[model samples]
Target chain A: MGRAIRQAPGRAPRTTRSLAHARFLLALTLAVVGLVLIVMLAVTIGPANVSLAQVSGSILGHLGLGATGTDSGAVPLLIDSIVWELRLPRVLTAAIVGAGLAVSGAVMQSVTRNPLADPYLLGLSSGASLGAVCVVILGVGFALPAAAFLGALAALFATLSIARVGGTITPARAVLAGLAIAQLAGAGTSFIIFWSAKGDSYREILNWLLGSVAGATWNSVIISGTALALVGTGVVLAATRLDAFAFGDTAAASLGINVNATRWALLGSVALLTGAMVAVSGAIGFVGLILPHLVRGLSGPSHRRLLPLVAVCGALFLVVADTLARTIFDPRELPVGIITAFIGVPVFIVLIKRKKSSAWS
Target chain B: MVVAVPGSTAGVVIENLSFSIDEQVILAGVSASVAAGTVTGLLGPNGAGKSTLLRLVGGLATPASGSVTLGGDEIGAMPRREAARRIALLEQNTAPSVDLSVEDVVLLGRIPHRTRLLGTFGGDDDRAVAAESLAAVGAGELVDRMWHTLSGGQQQRVQIARALAQRPSLLLLDEPTNHLDVSAQLSLLSQVGGLGTTAIMALHDLNLAAAFCDHILLLQDGKLVAAGTPAEVLVPEIIGEVYGVECDIIEHPRDGHPVIVFSAPRTAVAPMRAAASA
Candidate 1:
């Protein structure tokens, strides 16, 4: 009946616009490959002079894949221990933490409809730090990861309650509430450290606060890896629904999405993911904030494309950053968070300056 | 084919709907019915609850009391995805902070048709519908353009295209012509009028309502003050009583529809003469 409005001269014909999909697939493939290569390269670059071949041989031999004709006797046991025991766990833990934090950040940005939102914006990191520090100083019987997750959930509830006024959560109010909780949690963390921490334990708490993977073990790898698979996959699968939120709550609700429920679920998922990562990594900063922004430049704003790509890129970025943090100072080590910020700030500024136009105003 | 009549089971019926937030009522006991295959105008001044009524019908908000039925089915009882497949709402002043291409923005309308885990069960069909909707709204050429780059009218047109992509039977719009120029407004309304779907649009321009709407519902202070054909409801008394302004209604020579000409308020409150009585 409305055919009259369809008249236009020389209109472009609709072609199969599969190019974007092809590009996305290509990016995903590249990211997967890049992560593998970066992990391989990062494990080789540690203070122990493990060559690429020996590292591969050790990994293959451990996997029960026979080493490719390399002399097993030539590869020393200590180097194998350094590669397999020390560096590999740390690198894998960094990668998982990166992926989880990046996914959490992307989901947070989409749910809040705020471009600047990151995993830590809801006071997750500070709360987790508080939990971790309490366990460290007070010699609590509870596991640090469990305590940290609970603390993050507590902070989330507090932030949500404060932000929600008259049944609406404005972004400004949420950010403000998060800041308040973060500061409160940070003060508590500092107070616990000041009052109860003794000697080397204070150093331990300091390293945790600054976010180091120096003490990462196979346990950390298993914990962060499981969290990433369970919660991160859920967030990625929920990407389509997240796209509905681009316009705002009303439009999303009209599209048949239960906006409030979806928002709460997504928020809770992010909190869980971030809490798990923080429990393992002690609140590594900048990866959550910058990786999503950087990946968005390549994948555009579609979470379907952005989530997996950001996960991989974040993994690569953190693996590289952690490798540098441990090896750059030779005998001494720095917190990985310091390295991420040092590298991330410049890269972020460059990205901001390089873009002629932004998706957001 | 049996020609479906307007105001049939496919139409929308809102009965005694009331909504309040924080002890402030937004819509009160508003009852109205719109017929299928006709354009209905929701005419009201600012804060008159036109948007709220539309929201209730779109199933975005629940009425505190009473019910909304679409096609003889209670809307609140319908599954959200099922209801979305039938109805689309175009809201006012929605400037998304995200950067999305026009095509992607329109593709959002296909969400209701998509699976929960994986979106757009039929990708090719969804893309075609989005393209056709963009063309339907005269935004076909802007398909590749980023949303932030579009002008206000173009953005509005793209928003309409997004809504159209849903392939809805009942479309609700809030001030759909707020950003359009005069010519664009006329053409947009003409396009909507010819769509053959039941459309309930909240409008501020009384002349446009008179020209395009088959039925008019006038609201004042959350109450339905008048409802009928435009000729019956656009009378001066109802207009003045609701809008608090004096207005003259003239018949358009071309279409024989009522065109309102507004004037200053008939009663001007005089300043208190220096509290003379005190």
Candidate 2:
């Protein structure tokens, strides 16, 4: 089901085929290894003099797999707290957020048949931010995260409804509607935050708006992990329909796809993943937009190859970016969104300059 | 469960087939029949229901209170994919999507042959069949070329190859030669005509239709005004009545086929001027 179409010109070299397949597998494997190493380094490299061994043992012990700690007091407790309650979930949360966002982006791009279309481009993030803003600034919901999740979900629904006005959703129409609603949501959020400014509480708005995994804990990890598993399976199940649709709606229909059902099912799945991602990570932008394109470039735009490859690369991409955010300033941590945008902007510029955007269609 | 459709059958019959978009009445209750394994040509002016009737028979649209049937079964009664498996439709001016190679587009014709639960292309369904389809229309090398990068004629041939790949019992084409040059157009229609599959093609040029088609269907303002061999349907009186033009049609010397020659419209009102002179 996951086979990449073997296509090459002239007398296709056997070595070239094996090499390309080998390269894809190697890249994914190395990325996983690199992510694991970075997660360990990230756990131990802060102000505390925690060694690699200490972090590993703490993790192993927490998992009921390592040697017990020698120190019986606050030292062992602090180690357990940092490794278990803090760094572990933060790293896991970044990976999960990356996977969910990337998968949804790939799905959305294929469904919309527009390369620039990302899951959050439909106002999922801004909606979530609006939800968080009303709670954080106006004291709307004392539980800010839950409020942000609901707000994000609402925004996704609103954008989808506006785009689907005539019982048909075109690529240009959907994007236009999404942009309009996103601006409105942004304005509403700014109005609430600006009018109700009290002291330096603007910093709270910054954290949520800019996106941070600073809030990640074991609980968020569990919930986000479950959501990704359920939704990822759904995406893979719809893989053939996506492949058929890559040809366009008419072709897909001739192939016997119920265009309406497939569209709604895909819309619901991507919206859920986008909402869940924003709810957990407060909208770490750019990875969703750029990662799928990069993967598609490497492996041609077949969804069978594109979806899983995009997921792994997305997970690896976010974990590395978040690690840099934590380690770049060392003592003072920057938000992961800042790092993602900083990386995303130049790559996006290069993508724009590349004259084959028409090729994406 | 590969359940068969209730009314799936083996031959097509079009009765009073007509279609109009935005009230323009492209096809006016045109009726025709294409027997199994025979290649037929649909010939008419630019806006004729040639394509419209083809679409009707292909089940792309339902007729305006008319019936299109396969064997004894109405086309509207069969399930869509099962119906698609029976008839392959190649519409004109279809653009190839980005990054999809020619092989990918050709392989799409095998979609109906797929088992939905396990949607994998099997070993028996690989390069051999694709190569055979490509070879049928002399596109054996283009099986690897990117679809978006092909020339207009090459792309048309590739699409024909795709329809051939479907191995559909009934192949329906709508002006499959719109932008093609002379040789490409001839070889395409000629090859398809000899492919041993039942083919119904809408063609603009009466000469090519006359040369290659077993039977010709002539349409005018959506009416099935004429249907016969191309030589019979392409007479001067019928062509003039349908197109409002004076023309001389002569049989070709080498191949001995009927050829149509269009004369320019008269700027002078000859009938009124003759009356004034008198």
Candidate 3:
């Protein structure tokens, strides 16, 4: 065993027993600092020429601190309003949405004990899309995302129901059910979009298909961000149980996880986060699918390590993806969803080619 | 690490425990008492119901017509976590997950005792016993390694350590040494028997079972054909009647235990096959 440890490579020359512990601590410390920097950069980069001070001041004020609306109490409120009221919300929402999606993906992957199990593949985003579309186009229902939220919850429960038989959920059954239900919901959505028959409605729905932060507002951002923090932290704090989940059901059961209860808790939280994010930003893909996997490669697959790692990486990944989406096409901005897949795919392909880490055994 | 809670009786007892699956009677009508502080070997052949009986005992599978009592109480009535803490079962070929670390896998054994939702692995929760559990089967160094990277024999030992970490009063292991080498096989049985914890294991190796078991329960097609001390149950006549093989049951010189000397079955006139023309 000592020989194997020595052979693992990429360690300090001394290679004491404490080295792996030291490396983990270092990875955690660096990840935390890097996350803070990404948050600032994400908030700062935009088409609007808001100074860094203005960005910090608005953030501080939003946090209910003593920060003034104006940077030096000299500039007029006009520029501050543009920075605070307009671009800031979108950037913050991107981080919140990213964190929620990644954590959801991580938790989902653990619960199913299938590496391929992520929130997107389970039809959650598509379900949210169906709900949002129903409310927006039908004009007969509720708030913009509330309808979508319900849809995500419905899809989550439906999938669990389909997979479960006699109190046990097998990996084969779960993937099969998810594939069937996701396809079914997606077909229903396409039918609704085509049947709507109005050109303006088509464009609006199309814009949504390419998830945007164009409708970002402080109210929606606060709601989504708060939900993300509350639920995401809750999931992280429950990290140990999530780690047990990676051991599969009977082992987990003997380990005393009420397998059914744990499954429901993870699924409920994931569905809620997915619904809220999809409500705010339409159907952003790849961040949930790809970011968690990337983070796992850097840090191994311990959820205690994986969740926080993925949360930061997912936030940074989406924020950067959104920025590229806005900048790469200039005035004719591409949808953030387009940017995520466009950027996410090549990295994903490379990761696959390297065979350094497989999401599955 | 095995603790006896006040009023917590930790032995397993079966009374008329019959079970059927897919309309097939597996354990027809079985009754046995695996007393506290002894290792009971459930000895059987391929089609026997030893595994089924152990599953019912572990609370993994419900019996069709009877109950398995644990700690002198019906297992169905024991609180879920309470039951888990008192009894740990290890089955064969646990589909290894590549991503989990060995420590992460072992911490799972402590879950039944953890009341907090997060199940923090504090110093006490590390199962200071985990080290001993690992060392008993010689898997202590595998603690930090990724679980999937371990060799098959090493993996099996780690699993026993996990069950040991559970601090179970009654440990049930099913065919635990299937992939293990000879030394590992003897070493693991000695550890379990040495623990003085009540262990009822379904072991395929009759010789190993005879060497370690304080009591042997021979099952033929799910019925308890015979039971008692190893010497009493592992007789040459009983072995021939149950296994339908010619064998010699002799005293093991070193341990003064009964050992089997297997012999080829006597040839009988073949029941004629259908004629090729037909």
Candidate 4:
């Protein structure tokens, strides 16, 4: 019906169009290739010190291609176990969790219309920690990931209820309410840690709190992989709607969006995605906060171009960071969160100084 | 000018439209009709509910106890996407929270027309339409510029280009010339006149309304005070009654349209002020 309006005469020359999108696509393609390379390389960098050949041989052999393994003389059992059992699942978990957190962060920033927003800023991580603490320190019977998801959902409900008091939820009110819930959840987690945690068990609890994928198994990979595949795709497909919210609520409504429904759906999707990532990786920080902004610098703020690249960049970033976390201290490993923060703060500072005036409205 | 969509262009009819917020009435049973393919100016002082009335007509809000119909279809009953395809509203002083390119902002107008199930980005035809819309508004060269870097007048033009890209049969504008210079304002209003679609804009400038709009609807205290041609409705008495200001109307030298020159407030309040002092 509206095709005539689209067929206006003398179509504008294609060469006159902006090359920013072309540049963005090139960058996205490079990022995907870089991620694949890094994933293979990250698998080989450890105390075991395996080569790329061994890593590939182990992987292909496990996927039912036994010919490659026979060429390497049946691929030693120890190397195969390391590549398939320990390193592969941990690296995959890092990549999946990274993608999930980064997507959640991008969606959160757009939905809240705030540049500083991240998945963890809304109490999801603290709530998940509280859930994990209940099971670990207090001897609760629930599965750790399930408990964490429920706790994250509960925190989201609380934050929304507080924001909704006396009126509809504005972005400012929702952010403020999230801060309140984060603080409340943080205090509860601390109290439980101090009152009940005993001796060396405190170290384990601290490791989970600080965030790590060191304990990731095939089960962890399955949990986070499924979440990212489902919720992550849904969010990315709906990312275009996030652009409608760029101007304001009324403007989006005038653009034919059901503003309230779109906002709730996105926020809910982000919560589910963020909760799954946290359940698997124990609230890995900085990947969610820094990756989207870093990618946005390359892709501008159009969510369609910005999000897919952000997901890939995030996967590359965490895979590299987790590799450093395990190998940096030799036998004593550090949580991946520490490396991310160390990297994130400097990059974040540079971003703030460079784009301070132009990044925000 | 863009080709008008067949069968979608229709006049707006607001009948007994009333709306309130927290028990405070914003629009009180105001009724008005805008003929198809004609430019109408909505004029009133602050709190006169001109913007609210535009919102109702655009189907962004539903009336409390009455109806707004576009062509023969009730605006409130149409799907949001269908309503957006038929009506576009250019709001005043709205900017995106994130930095966006001028072309990206213009492409936003294509969202309602997206027919694919999971269309995450605009296609070739959409981009062509967006570029054409920008060219129509004299902003084709600004397609790559960042929105935040534009001057107020330039930004206003980009916003108009975005609205044009929507290809709506009916256009609603709230102070579309709000922050522009005199020449910019004149050129923008002229562009609006050239667009060939039905349009209703709320304007504070009487002379601009007289020069561009084919019809005038004067509002006062949530009610429509007058609805007619500028010569019929831009008389000094109606203007003074609605705006509480004294004004004179003269014929424009070139076009013979009403030229309203606003003067001081009316003298009705002098005796009341003297009695309060006593």
Best by DockQ: 1
Task: State the interface C-alpha RMSD of candidate 3.
Answer: 7.1
| lDDT measured at residue A347 in model 2 versus the true structure, 0 to 100 | 72
Instruction: Quote the positional error of residue B153 for candidate 1 in Å.
Output: 1.6
- Candidate 1 vs candidate 4: the lDDT winner is 1
Question: What would the DockQ be for model 2?
Answer: 0.22
Which residue runs does candidate 3 get wrong by more than 4 Å? A1-29, A61-75, A140-146, A157-177, A199-203, A206-210, A297-302, A343-361, B1-10, B20-28, B62-65, B122-127, B236-246, B263-278
Tell how far residue B272 is off in model 3, in angstroms. Answer: 17
What candidate 4 gets wrong by more than 4 Å, as runs, is A1-13, A16-22, A67-72, A135-143, A157-177, A199-201, A347-361, B1-8, B96-98, B266-278
TM-score winner between candidates 3 and 4: 4
Every candidate's lDDT: 0.80, 0.72, 0.73, 0.80
Candidate 3, B-chain TM: 0.88
Tens digits of per-residue lDDT for model 4, A71-120: 65657888888999999999989998888888888887787665556666
Runs of candidate 1 exceeding 4 Å displacement: A1-16, A67-74, A164-173, A345-361, B1-9, B267-278
Q: Candidate 4 lDDT (Cα, whole model)?
A: 0.80
Model 4 CAPRI quality: acceptable
By lDDT, rank the candidates, best first. 1, 4, 3, 2
**Error in Å for residue A315 of model 4:** 0.6
**What lDDT does model 2 reach?**
0.72
Q: Candidates sorted by DockQ, descending order? A: 1, 4, 3, 2
Each candidate structure's TM-score, on Cα atoms with residue i matched to residue i, is 0.91, 0.83, 0.85, 0.90
